[model samples]
Target chain A: MKLEILAALNAEREARRAAVLVTEIATGKQRLVREADLASDPLAETLAERLRMGKSGMAETPAGDVFLTVQAPPVRIVVTGAVHISQALAPMARLLGHDLTIVDPRTAFATPERFPDAPVHAEWPDDVLPKLGVDRYTAFVALTHDPKIDDPGLIHALRSRCFYIGALGSRKTHAKRVERLTAAGFTDKDIARIHAPIGLPIGAISPAEIALSIMGEITAALRLKPASAAQAAA
Target chain B: MLATDNDIMNRAEAWRREGKGVAIATVVETWGSAPRPVGSHLVIDDDGNFLGSVSGGCVEGAVVTEAVDVITSGAPKMLEFGVADETAWKVGLSCGGRIRVYVERVD
Candidate 1:
């Protein structure tokens, strides 16, 4: 790859945009295909599939064998609560190679000492999330159990393309929350996007176990087929 | 600090900007239980300094050594490591997985 191509690829990554580096094995000819240009590319369908999978592999075309380096944006986890569950989820998210941030309006809960690894924002989610720019690669989790904090964050997430939106609550609690969102003008289809009682059903009692379950659900939402991911989330 | 793939690529660009001969090796294909994924990268400088892993330390020494040569030659090379290859015994993946690494110099 040329230095210019490498520089451009790095720029795209810095901007958190997805791109593919296509390199021909035989000739070493290469080009960087930005996500915006995919629709017109010759390998649009294949590239789109690889980009969705976020995997790099070899593809055989009439030109010969080419390697597609699918550079998807790094997954980001934005938790609305810096509570016990968020504490447990922080390191796990980091271990799984996901960027994690803790947002809590309550200063006592959101503290740097509490979250040594992840960034803790002691501000309202509405004030912080817009700056974070939660994109499709982001996993938005509402764990505050406080509608005042989590509701606004959920509204932002619903407006954005974040892949996963999970809210930690009981079935009864979610039912009430659903009513509130419905009154807020969200239809059943839009409100259905949230994975209520957040996390996979694993009979988790401890906060750490709950964190594990949440991570599992997020992984399923990210890696599994969309239809199966919805079932898994359910 | 653990260096992510993004960090590795950024370091490669920084090394090039410093006028150091840099070569980047990427795992293009893998079979069986390969330690690293296909998109994993290992960036090396002319002095054999490298960051990141193509095989989680199993074949990095070989990849780094070959990367130095690619930096000097300015030509790309495809390296394969597996239980089936003779060199696997020297720098083989203990997990018995096959991986194809493409090493190219950054001009």
Candidate 2:
């Protein structure tokens, strides 16, 4: 029984998935809790409530004994340009355990020779992006600086609910791009989703500095607390 | 008995027991002009161990001292050192930033 429990814990950790083991420690009623959906998991629901209340340690359970283990998955970064900034950004993103992919229709730019260790896709955005299936866990960046390449990618990214959609450009260029997007029927709200002039206002001049600013902005976007929720929490 | 810290230690210990060498690095706190934030950690093993950060390079000597003790005794410790200390100037942290780092041997 102990070996079985250990094995389950190991498997969950290996998969990088969260699990809760509900056991009646006093009564020795041990039941492994696995729910298809997190919301439906009673043990997880209870544990989350307890955590929110800042409570820990053994808790009485109607069942037997229960322990919750959570393993967070690594983040993913999908760069839609094989530009110079991407050459620097990809390595840093990889160090942070972000699975990165570089897509560009320009085969010369997207070749592995340019991005030695990255996954390169030498295909058009419309052809390549849908197969990748961007998700909420994914961060998409349109760094091509050319609307012909960046626009279709941004449209795809915005439609798929990616967590971050960043486009590299000047303020004037972005304004012009927005006009084009609006003409194409994207609502203001959809346009607002983009992080144009993508990086932080760090006055970055070089490609590496620009990459750093973009990374910093992406990190902030990921970690920043929602302003609307502060009032609600207060 | 913080569950998060305990869990992290347990995992490190398990790796050590399986022939993996472990070193724990802690961030005590940050004052000014620190590269890594407070509470950032770098863990290293026998081959130059690292996990978290103490201060970019300013107070690494003090952190290494605690780390060596942890490797020998398998005990945890809270080490505090900052620019206010006399030695901080020698470590190149005289820039007015201070940090406290806690190093432990989880294995």
Candidate 3:
């Protein structure tokens, strides 16, 4: 690898920016492609597709077969409510390669011992959500079942365009939650982004099972047709 | 295949800086039923010690052999392993596939 390319890649890794290292197979010509560079590359269209999918693969171009090693930042998960589900979720999400932050104003449940190895915060959603830097590569999971705890975080997530937004509740509970979000000034489409009755319909009973379902949904949202590609296809 | 495991790139760079010759073999392309996804890496140090994997095991032996030469010659090379009837029989593959690997020196 060229020193310049390597240095550029290291800098991107430091800043947690998405980047791609494209290696031209025939001549071994290599260059770094940051997310912002996609629109200008000769292979812009294909690169855009690959970036949106967050995948690295061999792309056949007019020049040659170029191998793209996509390096998207690790998905950050802001899990509000350090409840039983979150206790199970923190480690599971970590095992699945996600950075997790547990936010709950209740210090008893959000203690370091309760969620060891994860960054725990005894701060409210409005206080901690901005500090977490929730972005497109982030996922927000609301498990508190309290509007005070979940609503602010969900609104922040919706505004930030985080890849996934999920809230825990029953169908009726979700309906009321929907009314609250609507009244709070979120559009219908924005309110629809929340995966109310959070997690998949897996008939999950235990906290661990519920956590597994949430992780599955989060992964699906991250890997399978991120909203940009879906909108492009639409 | 949805995730990259055991980051081999950083290990390769560190090994080279530590005064050991290192080569990295990466899966550049795959066809048919390949075991590993594209961009998977296997880092081989001068002593034939390797970390990470391009294939589960089916093609590591061949890729390592190429990586050794890349380390020795300081020249990168691309390797192609395709599913022939004999190769499928030898590797005990229930399916057929093709893999293209690029082996290059760390420095």
Candidate 4:
């Protein structure tokens, strides 16, 4: 009992250290803001007033009713296929603050020199993804166009709730892929979540153009509302 | 309260332990020469204590005043500032762009 009490106390202390709570007075909603201190911090006064009013939203601090809204730098992007599109996409994604990782069983394609800035994992998707623990913030793309590599990654991404999942293929290819996924027990809704025919319909032809489309779609997914909602709004 | 870099976490924790309320404001969307970028954040306590920033000091004073009211009334609000507004220019960001700030309480 004493040990359990000590553990509870430690957990409470850790939570307090990591998060600030903000409580909205009118709605009574509370949000946790991750703790961060950027000096010359412009948001300080605004946060204080919001706290006073009991407004609930995540901030980068732990004061008042303000809870911490933690932001991890270099958002993670995991690409399952190391195709030419992956090469172009990796660098472009890096420019926009994504920490890119390329995984492929093809030793020739997945190399540190080819993807210099990105972390290249020359392992099969089944072996790699489990260790990475893809989360809601991570973006996953299957560019191999080969079911042997793409299928397992798709299954993993679908199960884990990754923020963005795109596969490069034609509608016909996606249809065939859907058959495989359904046989493996993925529901219709789950299959629909995959952004196959990947990217905005900008009439992309080259590998670079395709990469741009994929990146644009992923960026929109991260910042704006869901694709269905965005279409509705438009 | 003024905070040193090392003391920020400790100060925030202390505030929470005292049962005080806190509010956060964020620059969710910006357009046409807004002073700050999207994802900028500001935090304030019920007594008007503050941390972080949203704008380039152009509308912080006004935001604080509004936050105080929000704290007292327990309401959330969205504030917009643009070059078209006289007060917005008076505060310093007269660059002729618009910014939307979302203010909410989180505790």
Candidate 5:
């Protein structure tokens, strides 16, 4: 590993860009492949598969045996409400190594005392989501149950490439939400991305159980294959 | 203070920039119930000082010693550790797992 290569890898991480450090095990030859360059690399297909899986391991290439250190950006959880579920979720998200942020316009709800482990923002989602830079690595959850707050955040999340978007609501509430979003010009296809009636069907009763179900769903969305994840979520 | 993978890499780059001979050991492969997953890192300096863990503190001491040698020789080495009884004299995982570690110098 050259000093320059290590420095470059660190720089890519700081910039929150995905990259892989390819090291040939036999000779110690190494190279850094940024996500943008994956298409042109000779090992493009294999690298893309590994990147999608977000796992680092030994790869047997026709050229040689190599190790790929896949550096996908850490997943960030952006919740639109600092309610009871968020309070229970903040700690769990930290335990799972995901960055969790709580946003709510209600000062009483978004108190530091309530969410000691997470950053509590006493602001609206529309005002904060942009600055948070919710990207492909983000899991956006609308838990406020307030259309004024959750609707704007949903719009932002839909426009961005956030991997997971869930909303806390029942089927009836989601129907209303769908109507509003449709009136707002979001096609049914774009609106379909949201996991309304949020969380997996675990028959959750309490707020903490609800949080666990939501977290479980998010983990499935992240780790499972797309087809499997859809099946699990369904 | 739990060190993330990024923190280990950052520390490795920082140590090298500070003019210290540094080596990084990574768990490249794992079989069975290995304590740490593949791609886990442990960065060491010439002085045998290390940060991070390739195997939940089970074989880090051995890795650090080899990493110091790799730093001095500038040649990467592949190291394997298995069950304690299999590696009678060597440090091994109590969890009955096998792991392959790659130790390389940062030049």
Candidate 6:
């Protein structure tokens, strides 16, 4: 409730940075815990775990019970393709509480009419990806089958630590695509991050179904950790 | 309209600035069959009016009922509810799940 604390919390929200307000349940003492400051907090271990999950909760600590009210920025999905699947995906991502931007070099397909809600960039990835400012909270999906556009987008996405990167292509096509990326200087680990054929396999045959599957897969990728890590956390 | 978490926080701060007491109820933890995820929030004013939801249909009434007291007493409280617990079932947490909620008066 201090004026300084209030200003700091509001500033973080304005900047769309993730922060947690830690409250001491016993004495009503409190402090703001920005994601950047987690490493130095006394409750660093639990704070990092909760911040990764991006949830507010009561944490039992040696000091006492502390309630962490997390303020995480909304996730943004950067898509390179303004095809039919993107038409379905733009709205779908918004409904799932994600902010999305679609980039396509084709002005004909990347029209405001097709995506009334999301921003459409009729420019190449090389020109647009930097403008979008993809970050750790950003998810990159290349729905455009054109290697020229999709490959460059993947390179930019991999250069940073965007949480998810998926590309649309069949397994055979993806193998060839991997070869191309490898030759272009991506390591196997970086290539492994791409969800080739993109989306969870729910027998998606329609554009809408495929969009739904892609969102589902992205949600799983964000919320569900690997089995071994999950067990360790438990 | 559904209020986002920031909306709830901002609104609570605005209400306080306007001299109206505010209390926030947040879902801190949940077990099986929890309809809402942890960190979901419902904010209430001194008048018992509220925005957002803590549970789809469970434990909300009790949480709000306590928020009024929180606004008056300026004390924070933590509550737990579960279907197996008879007291929780009486309070409408009959969703075959367990949830812990922490309510505090936000100044």
Instruction: For candidate 6, write residues B16-99 as lDDT tens digits.
Output: 778888888888888998878888888888888887787785667788899999888988888887774654337655678888
User: What ranking emerges by TM-score with the best candidate at the front?
Assistant: 1, 3, 6, 5, 2, 4
Give one digit per residue, the lDDT tens place, for model 3 in A29-145: 888989887789888888877877777898898887888988777778999999999999988876776788999999888899998859999999999899778877888999998
Question: Ten consecutive residues with minimal summed lDDT in candidate 5 chain A?
Answer: A225-234
Clashing pairs in 5: none
Best by TM-score: 1
Location of the lowest summed lDDT over 10 successive residues in candidate 3 chain A:
A225-234
Tell me the spans in candidate 3 whose CA falls farther than 4 Å from its real position. A39-42, A227-234, B1-6, B84-94
The DockQ scores of all candidates, in the order shown, are 0.70, 0.07, 0.39, 0.06, 0.60, 0.45
The clash count for each model shown is 0, 23, 0, 59, 0, 0
Deviation in Å, model 3, residue A171 alpha carbon: 1.7
- Chain A TM-scores, per candidate, are 0.90, 0.76, 0.89, 0.70, 0.87, 0.86
TM-score of each: 0.88, 0.60, 0.87, 0.57, 0.84, 0.85
Poorly placed runs, candidate 6 (over 4 Å): A1-14, A53-55, A226-234, B1-7, B10-20, B84-89
Reference-based TM-score, model 5: 0.84
TM-score of 2: 0.60
Best of the two (2, 6) by TM-score: 6
Residue lDDT tens for model 4, B1-107: 33322233334445555777655566756778877666566667778887667777777777777777766666678787766454434554567787767675543
Best by the DockQ measure: 1
lDDT (Cα atoms) of all candidates against the true structure = 0.91, 0.65, 0.81, 0.67, 0.90, 0.82
For model 5, residues A24-88, the per-residue Cα lDDT tens digits are: 98889999999999999999998988877788999999988999999988778999998999999
Q: Candidates 3 and 4: which is better by lDDT?
A: 3
How well is each residue in A46-163 modelled by candidate 2, as lDDT tens digits?
8555323322234555665343323233356888899999999988776665668899999889989889758999998888899887755567899998899999998898787566
DockQ ranking, high to low: 1, 5, 6, 3, 2, 4
Residues B15-34, candidate 3, lDDT per residue (tens digit)?
A: 77788888878888888998
Candidate 2 chain A worst ten-residue window by lDDT: A225-234
